[model samples]
Structures are given as C-alpha cells and as structure tokens.
Target: MHALPDIVGYLAAIIGTICWIPQTIKAWTTKETKDLSIWANILVLLTITLWFIYGILIGSIPLILGNLISICAVGAIVIAIFRFRSQ
Candidate 1:
C-alpha cells in the first residue's frame, strides 16, 4: 500500500537518525576514533552523501535531515579517528 511506504520511510529515518547519536556522543566525549575503520567510514559517508542527494531530488525532508545528521556524525568520527591515530 502507499501508506506502508510512508510509514516505513518515517520509521527508518527516525531509527537511523537516532542510531547515530551514540556514535556522535562517544566521539565527542572520547575524542577518539581509533576503533573506527577508515574504509568503513568512507563507505558510510559516501552512502549518506548519495542518500542526501536523493532526498533533495525527491524533496523528502525526513531523508534529507536524517542523512544530513548522519553525515555530521560520520564526519566527526572520521576526523577523530585520524586525529587520534596520528597521536
């Protein structure tokens, strides 16, 4: 049904957005990203980038916001990982 897709999208966006909070909090508090894999993060970032673009193309606020937040969270982790790794 058409309604099912909307419901699923909303739920997915909420869960995906909230799921990122822990990683963001941990990175902010610990300022350590040594445990995160560069390749993994890169892949995730790229995926998010594509999702964000898709969201914009379709004018989906949930997708846009969710992926935008994910980008920030993943980007922070990547920065921390590199910073801590160097030190």
Candidate 2:
C-alpha cells in the first residue's frame, strides 16, 4: 500500500516551496538581475539539486516533489540572470 504524505512533511514542503515565490516574483518584476548575486544563486541551485537527489534516494515523495518545484523556480531566476546579463 502506498503511504500517504505525512502532514508535517507536506506542510514543510509547502512552506519551502512557497518561500521561493517572492524571489521569482521579484525577478519577474525587475527583469534586471544585477541586484542578485550569481554566486548565491549558483550555491542555492546546487544545494537544491543535491536535496532533490537525496529526496529521490530516500524515496520521500514530499521531499522529492518539493525540491523539484524549487529547482524550477530558482532555476528560472538563475537563467534569467545569466540571460539578461549577457545582453
């Protein structure tokens, strides 16, 4: 039988995932990446990437799913920074 998502785990995932929204919105609004640090984004993206791998390894859906969403959001910010900065 498939185990349901733990309530606390679900809440944790939601909180972490939602926390990324403000950064995303800020990037979207400004369309300027100069205010953000490339090193910080790279570090965060790397950390999230590892967390995602760990989540998968542990077979924790909440962890895996949450990190995946975070990667996308943060990834977009990283890409936007590089893309806009390049021009």
Candidate 3:
C-alpha cells in the first residue's frame, strides 16, 4: 500500500536525522571541532537545503521533514565549528 512506503520513508528519515546527534553533541560539549571539516559541513548543509527545497516542490512530507531536521542538525555543526574554532 502507499502508506507502507511513506512509513518506511519516515522511518529512514528519522534514523538518518538521528545519526547526527552524537556528532552534534560531541562538538558542542567538547567544544572541539578541529577534527571536523568546515567545508564538508557547509557542503552537507547546502546539499540538505537543496533536498528540502526539492521536497517542498514535490510535496513529500517525509522528505520535507527529514531535510528540514537535517538542516538544523548540520547547521548547528557549522555554528559549532565556527564558534569553537581552534585559536
């Protein structure tokens, strides 16, 4: 059924979004982002933003929700990188 695929999509989105939690937590708590690449994070943010836009265009709730959350998670990492940059 159509509902089953949407359920799967939502599940995947949730798991994927959650994957960033540990990294975000570590970056914020330790205040250490030296090992993290700013460019990579920025690129990821950009990529997710595009996906979010595409999701909106297609009206896919799962994609929209997932990418929206990803943007926040990755955006936080980017902020952490700048805020905690090594002196």
Best by lDDT: 3
> TM-scores across all candidates?
0.80, 0.80, 0.83
Worst 10 residues of 1 by lDDT: 78-87
What is candidate 2's TM-score against the reference?
0.80
lDDT winner between 2 and 3, please give it: 3
Give the TM-score (vs. native) of candidate 3. 0.83
lDDT of each: 0.84, 0.86, 0.89
Q: Model 1, 1-87: lDDT tens per residue?
A: 699999998788788876866886897788877777889988988999899999999999978988999998888877777777765
- Pick out the ten consecutive residues of candidate 2 with the lowest summed lDDT: 1-10
Candidates in descending TM-score order: 3, 2, 1
Clashes of each: 0, 0, 0
Candidate 3 residue 40 C-alpha distance from true site, Å: 0.8
The segments of candidate 3 whose C-alpha lies over 4 angstroms from its true place after superposition are 1-11
Write model 3 residue lDDT over 1-87, tens digit each, in one string.
699999998788789877887888899999989989999999999999999999999999878888888888889999999998964
Question: For model 1, what is the error of residue 10's alpha carbon versus the real structure, in angstroms, after optimal superposition?
Answer: 2.1
Q: Candidate 2 clashing pairs?
A: none
